[model samples]
Target: MLSARQRQLDRVRTFLFGSRTHYGAVFTVFLYALLIAIGFVYLYPLLFMFVTSIKSPEDLLNPMVQWVPTQIYTENYAKAYRVLNYPQTLTASVVMSVVPSALQVAVASLVGYGLARYRFPGKGLVLALVLATFIIPPQNTVIPQMLTYKQYGLLGSPLSLFLPAAFGQGFKSAIFILVFYQTFLTLPKVLEEAARLDGASDLRIFLTIALPAAVPAFIVLFVFSVVWYWNETFLTVIFLEGGVTTLPMQLSKFAQAYENLYPPGVVNIFDRLNEAIKMAGTFLNILPLLVMYFILQRWFVESIERTGIAGE
Candidate 1:
């Protein structure tokens, strides 16, 4: 009976503490708890924003209301929608982000492929320059670029944003370049050699053999580029301030725009701009980004896995 009890105790310990083959029940519970804690930390702000956005003015004023509102009030969204000029600004944002992202990805891929696959004069210098560009703050270059754009009459036009991307100089272009470079470096060169032996020209070999293998990298970079471009406000304000208005651009000036739409003296105090309305605007500003992220989340995970940088 003593030996049997000892064996039962050992089995229970093993079940709780895990074996070489599998995790234990305790570990699984702890891991899930940690994940839930981390998830809450990241999701709290979004939850607060969404809840606040739907709160009525009365709920906002009521001290009793914190996480949950008494009722869902959508008036804030209606007011915010008009203040943001959602339809027009959303279109502009999509154009601004997608166009530059496509151009940036294309340019980065070529630059990365060249850096990874070729030996050239001043290769070290070129790489050093790309890294330097990545490290350098955009503030240092924005004024000069703005002036140049003004001089060339490209200011406030999409070309002002596009030209740099087309030349592999878009915002965070260096990172994407490095990503592709690393991706290409990992690819087996034997395929390229085989293509070459088959009488494929350099460009043809790259197009047929190398580019297809780097599709995952391309998707990852493009998605990230789109997010960066979509969220960029500083350069957009400097270059496209007068001519175009993106969601971020409009969001920054939400208060002023709200006043313009509904003057304080003309409207009742309850109808005036409030935190709920501001939260609504903020939520609207990020809604598209959330949608995009959710839709492409699987692609992002898969691409990251394929790029072999998931651990990184």
Candidate 2:
């Protein structure tokens, strides 16, 4: 009985400290630590922005006030909101970003479906061209695009953005197409064949079967499109030419706008109001995106995981 008990204890010790378990535990700890460090590095800037935005002018001037403010200045947000023309700009951003994103998804899905399911002449060539388009920078074609838009009288209109997306040439459209292509290809053929044998039309089969399976991809693409379009400035500045002013563009020009709106003596160069307003603008600009991400976070995560599974 004593010998058996001793052997059992030895087995338990070996199991706990065995080569496989020990290596796995060490790797897991290292991975978690690395992730935490990376998260802190990335989040520090946003944290500072929030802290500074809430600081009063007096608190900001005091060298002692670094992390926390003695008094929270909520008025910064109010002033920032007025400076940004939040109501109008928010409407413009949603129309510009969300509309184009939805249109691009529709165009990409159709193109990807055709490429994946059909065998046409020059099929390989078409796929190669799509891949080639991914490598070509958008800036290289901006000159020609501007010229073409000018000829069509689309230079100052939102149509310039929408038409390209409607025709399957939106920003980073190739990636979206690839995602759908891979997703459609991964679906089992038996499902489609069964529908066909039941005398269902191709459209009916796609709408009923294929589209449902690809819901995850759609959600993922929509989120990405909104973020990219929201953050876009350089292209919008050129295309719209002051016709549209998004949150980012407004934030970038906050100082000039502020000076124009108020008297010079109202705020000094190093005044906390100046910096705080800008910080508050930045925070408000991203607030909607933050809300959106939090709301759809589960769907977004599931979409990515599902896309990976489909690719595999």
Candidate 3:
């Protein structure tokens, strides 16, 4: 018994210095620590926003109150809602984000499926062009796009944005196409062949088998598309202009509105119009995204794993 115990201790010491087991454990610990640090870095800003948003004017003014507020200021949310014109902006944001996401998802999926399953002349060139297009920053084309939209009197219309996405030219659309392409490429050829042997038409097989099998890809793309569209400010300003207002746009306008509402001449305004209110508006702007991520985080993880299988 003593010899067996002595051998186990010696093995453990040896493993710690020279074996994969201890090295793996140490590497995992380091990775976990690194992830936790990164998580904190990303989350700290959000945490500050929530905390600052819930603070009352008095609590905000008090430098001593860093983490906890003396009193919760529920009114900040009400003020933010009013400032943002929440109902109207929320509706516009939903339309802007969801509509483009749906259109882009459908179009990109078809394009990706075709690229992955079929081979033809110029296929490689087409894919290369797509990837190259992604590298060309949107800023270069903004002038031409604006001029074209202006020529058609679509400067302030959502259609200006929608039409581009309908044609599979939406924001970061090439990336979504690539994602779907990679996912489709990972599917087993036997399943497709089996379906074909059963007299399944190409379209029917794609809709019934290929698409259904790539649910994770769809979910991942949809979520990412929504996020990109939702956070988009530059394109929204250029295309929709004043015609549509989303939460992020609303937040940008808040500072101007604040200065106008409480000019430098105003008295006792320092306590009311502070960073807390600005942060409150920011919190409201991002709340929907936070809710969405929490709800679909599981699917996101699965998608990450599945997306990597193509390279493997």
Candidate 4:
């Protein structure tokens, strides 16, 4: 009986402690606990924003209501939607983000492919320049670029954003170039050699062999570029200020817009803008990005895995 009892205890210990090949119950639980804590930390703000956005003015005033509201208030969303000019601003934001992203990716890919596949004079200097561009603050160049755009009569036009991206000088363009460079550098050279042996031109080799292998890298860069452009406000404000209005831009001026819509002295206190309404506007601003992320998350993850970005 003592020997049988000892064996049972040993089995229980092993199951809780794990073996060399498998994690134990305790470890699995601890790992999940840690993950949950980290997830909560990141998600806390979003949860607060959502909850606050749905809170009624009364709930905002109620000291007892912190997390849960007495009732769902959709009036905040309606007010925010109008203030943001949701339809028009959403369209502008999409165009600004997508167009620049496409142009940036196309330019960066070519530049990266050239850097990876060929030896050329001043190649090191070229790379150093690209790195320098990345390190340099955009604030330093904004004034000059703005002036140049004005001189060329391109200020407040999408071309102000497009031209730089088309030339591989978009926001964070250096990083995308490097990502592509690393991706193309890792490709098997034998395939390119075989293509060359078949009398394929350099362009043909790149198109058939290198391009296909780098699809994951392309997807990753485009997604990143889109997100960056979507969130960019400084350059957009300076360059596209007069011509276009994005969701973020509108959100920044939400207070002024709200005042215009409902004069504080004229409207009832209940109709005046409050924290709930501001939160609603903030939520609306990021809602499209959330939708985009959910839709592309699978592709984003697969591409990241294939590109091995984290490892690099």
TM-score for each candidate, following the candidate numbering: 0.95, 0.87, 0.87, 0.95
Candidate 3 lDDT, 233-264, residue by residue in tens: 99898888768888888888997766665565
Name the runs in model 2 displaced over 4 angstroms: 1-32, 265-273, 309-312
TM-score of 4: 0.95
CA-only RMSD, every prediction: 1.8, 3.1, 3.2, 1.8
> How many clashes does each candidate structure show, in the order listed?
0, 0, 0, 0
Tell me the tens digit of each residue's lDDT in model 4 across 1-312.
Answer: 569989999889889989889889999999999999999998999999999999998999999999999999999999999989999999999999999999999888899999998999999999999999999998999999999999999999989999999999999999988888888888889999988998999988888888888888888889899999999999999999989898999999999999998899999999999999999999999999999899999988987887887526
Superposed Cα deviation of residue 31, candidate 1 (Å): 2.2
lDDT of each: 0.92, 0.82, 0.85, 0.92
Residue 122 lDDT, candidate 4, scale 0-100: 97
Regions of candidate 4 where Cα sits further than 4 Å from its true position? 310-312
Better by TM-score, candidate 3 or 1: 1
46 in model 4: Cα distance from truth in Å? 0.8
Worst 10 residues of 1 by lDDT: 303-312
lDDT of 1: 0.92
RMSD of 3: 3.2
Q: Write the number of the candidate with greater TM-score, choosing between 2 and 4.
A: 4
Q: How accurate is candidate 3 locally (lDDT)?
A: 0.85
